[model samples]
Target: ERRFSVDLVGEVVRNFTLTLWNTYAFLVSYANLDGWQPAAGGSPAAPAALTDLDRWILSELHTLVGSVTAAFEGYDVTGATRPIERFVYDLSNWYVRRSRRRFWKSGAGPDKQAAYATLHECLLTLSKLLAPSMPFVADAIYRNLAGAQQPESVHLADWPAAEAARIDPALNHDMQIVQRLVSLGHSARQRSKLKVRQPLPEAAFWAGADAAGVIARHGALIADELNVKQVRLLNSDLEAVAYELHALPRELGQKYGSRLPAVRDALAALDAATAARTLLAGQPLALQVDGMALELLPTEVEVRLQARSGFAVAAEGGLVAALVTDLTPELVREGLAREVVRRVQELRKSSGFQISDRIRVRFQASAQIAQAIAEHHDYIAGETLAVALQAGAVSADAWLIDAESLAVQIELAG
Candidate 1:
């Protein structure tokens, strides 16, 4: 007979329960499921007007379906879980997280409907894909999403087929690069002890030719993700920064056994700016040693960037880096406005206000924060679903909020 400890079983049960509850909270609460459902045709159709983010997610979904199918066919349970996990992460973290405002916007328009449809499709597809390994959880999601229209049991549903036409390899590749750059941008902010909610004036990305092109194409996304007003590709600007080059001893030694010392000395002595420019241009660095010219490929030398005095930089594999520390007065004001919005949101949550609830806000702030609120009145109101926002004293029943050492009061409308 197999024996299971009660403590171990209790822990497992608690974890499972929390996981299900969190999943439900995300789908029903965060995603606003009341407004999202499969349409009359059954499966949610791809929206007619799809943004780059939407298209990229759809492409990823197609890729995930193929991976899951292959893994299941090969009887590799662990392999199947990998794609499911990745898809879920991307769906919740990237797609839904970024598209929250679109869904929460007051009116239902084509764009809003499209966001709903895209997310709905992703969730439903994810349900069917996950049904094999997590039948109970999958059934709950599937039933709530599609039980009324489709098969009652998730197990009875057919496996989701990959839509080859929806798969865009180029877009996927570009999005992956963008994701990496955004993650590095966050790392840069964390290193500088800067909060992401604070808006920065600009961020510069130094990437290889291909990655640079993709970054340029998706510059706006990088900016938004990093909470910066502008994203500038640091192609020419790389010369302004300092670079330290280290010759890989093992690789270079194998190529030039006796000349290794000369190569190392030459590499260290090379003009940092010129070497950066040369490597960025995808050209080999030519060195003259012992009356013979030897060419050093870009890969033969590892490059490290020294963050300039006014910049905070985070680099990955020396191929990509982001600089984002400059803050102008205007940018600081905007950052203050963003901070105010966050504080108000926290107050709303604490007051037990529903996501759709509108409130009246009155604030008494420092001159700087008040000025910021005046400048971004409409923006703050829109974001927080405030029916009215003004500078004044708080009413007795109003919720009080403190942001950046400034006092604010908010009252939900009946």
Candidate 2:
């Protein structure tokens, strides 16, 4: 309990502080330069077009507003705190993390503008929602985000009203499915000893019929999050999975008191594979025992899934993910490119380069690393904001980064 408290407090402080500060920096750096404000008249127009991610976040925000408001009105402090905590988590980890590139891109296109507006709105709303729980931090956020044009204090501002029309249950459901698959993918990678930095060819998800379409719709998002080349929603992959069913003796015995042994024998004789598959497919398993017909419900049996060889599997609450462990030459090259980018970024930070500073990169490395850089030259250059990338000796002033059997040097371009 003590450790749990410490961890939760640390997570809240780290995530909330960094994310809020970053949001303030973004608004000051980008939106202010564009003369944008969160006030009613001065704010940028609502995005004419919203991505699926955008809509999902908006819906989640609406839900948060309703939940928090109801909790406060009912005098339930813990309930109110829970919603605020969850919203902060999703806003920082999911929304901000995924949409960072949009905010960082140089130009102020429609997409960038929409991203800025959406984040601004979210931050402002969060200020009001959090004011009652965290007065000082909430007030600071509200003032920085809204004080310039609106209320002088967050406490003086009216509570944000939830928008019912913006809520989309279908989109929220799909996003939840995507989140689950991404989590399972992380577990599979851990089990296989594969770092997320190393790219994989594919990850497979076995979704029920009701959720298969939803999972397929967000295949690209899942693939990117998992750092895999592709995502396959394998509705039929269950054939490769084996399942075992254990009859709950207590529950079965309660129903068949005198005939418990007979019922147990009938269950033991049932075709395990067929029964497993039938139950997994959400169909009832029927049995003809002692001249009586009976159908088995899920509660009467416990199911366990076993994966075949060559796959890393993780499952929870009826959802399963099977990640392919085989890595190809092309995938390895891409993985190396990613590693190079990571190293260069680290060098930039260590060398005290500004976030907006463009630089020239120079490297002398092994033949394999050289090939990877050459093949993915454009990607490396764009990601690091490099004006030039070349292969050769490192300059005396450049920062040197060494990896296993690979070395590279980078310097800020004048």
Candidate 3:
């Protein structure tokens, strides 16, 4: 019953993501099959045994779907729209980017395959949920993944039956804490104006018991996303979280004269959380400095944080850092492989390589990269469409440059 033009819808489509919208339509590549889907279909199916992580994701999805659908029924398309988009854009993008390879090479392995297949199924389920809001984007993803293989269009797929039985509440809460922990790091980067691509040596946080498990399970995810080498959990109480308080010693000293310490102490005595919120909200405070009435505005001071134990601690903007642990050689190499694929994909995008275009690539690089390529040779070949790669040879028809700290070239081979 809602009315808008194709142009308007097209414009809205541009604002949404393909994977996000695909979650709206149901099954991929299928047309007009809305009541049932490839996995659970419309009625209901018992979930195949899934990973705790996977089950947790499904639990989150179901939570969102019930709420989103209710919003839709109430004519709050915007409300329905936002959650699905966020889950796909945030959770799916973050997780899939971190775990794709385990699925890629699983072949017939049941557990790993289940891990991947569950995610894949989740993606489809989400696309159906989103299609009511964004048609074009949902259709494209649906067509690509399941369309040719099974379904005709994602839009026609039915909504999956809602089930809350499989969700892990503890995992969900822990994840939210971890998410907040990651956000604190990202906010720090924002304050520093640091681009995510730049790597950092380490980040340490007062990893409390509440967020510890979440951080442990996805510590690698945090490192990869934040470009930090190491994450640490420290039990310390004295590390200062930084922020501009309403009264810095020198600034307040000039105003308060002999009373500066008392004023500073009073301000410091306020909990970090309250001080930050008050500062952010532009709330005004009244104080007497040298027996003169003073009014304080929020922006006059700044804040930052360092880890502490039993300090009941936090950073300005309420950011709490999460620690990272464990890095394996295999993990590093796999990350490099993804970087190589990214370079290839970027070139393809720039040079107008068609979706199905076959290509050849040659790489010239240091021994380390050469070995990485040699080790993941099949993966590299499949990823880059490269017919051959050698340590010394250069491609005659290829784009050549550097990637993963290695010189490389790629082209359509004759």
Model 2 — which ten-residue stretch has the worst lDDT? 396-405
After the best TM-score superposition of candidate 2, give how far the Cα of residue 136 lies from its true spot, in angstroms.
0.8
- Where model 2 places Cα greater than 4 Å from the true spot, the runs are 1-12, 15-45, 243-310, 395-404
The local lDDT score (0 to 100) that residue 79 gets in candidate 1 is 96
Model 2 pairs whose backbones collide: none
RMSD of each: 5.5, 4.7, 7.7
Rank the candidate models, highest lDDT first: 2, 1, 3
lDDT of each: 0.77, 0.77, 0.59
TM-score of 2: 0.81
- Between candidates 1 and 3, the TM-score winner: 1
Question: What is the C-alpha local distance difference test score of candidate 1?
Answer: 0.77
Tens digits of per-residue lDDT for model 3, 138-209:
677666556344568876666655676755677778667766777777766665554454456556565556
Q: Candidates ranked by TM-score, best first?
A: 2, 1, 3
Q: Residue 47 error for model 3, in Å?
A: 6.1
Candidate number with greatest TM-score: 2
Query: Residue 366's C-alpha lDDT in candidate 2?
Result: 71
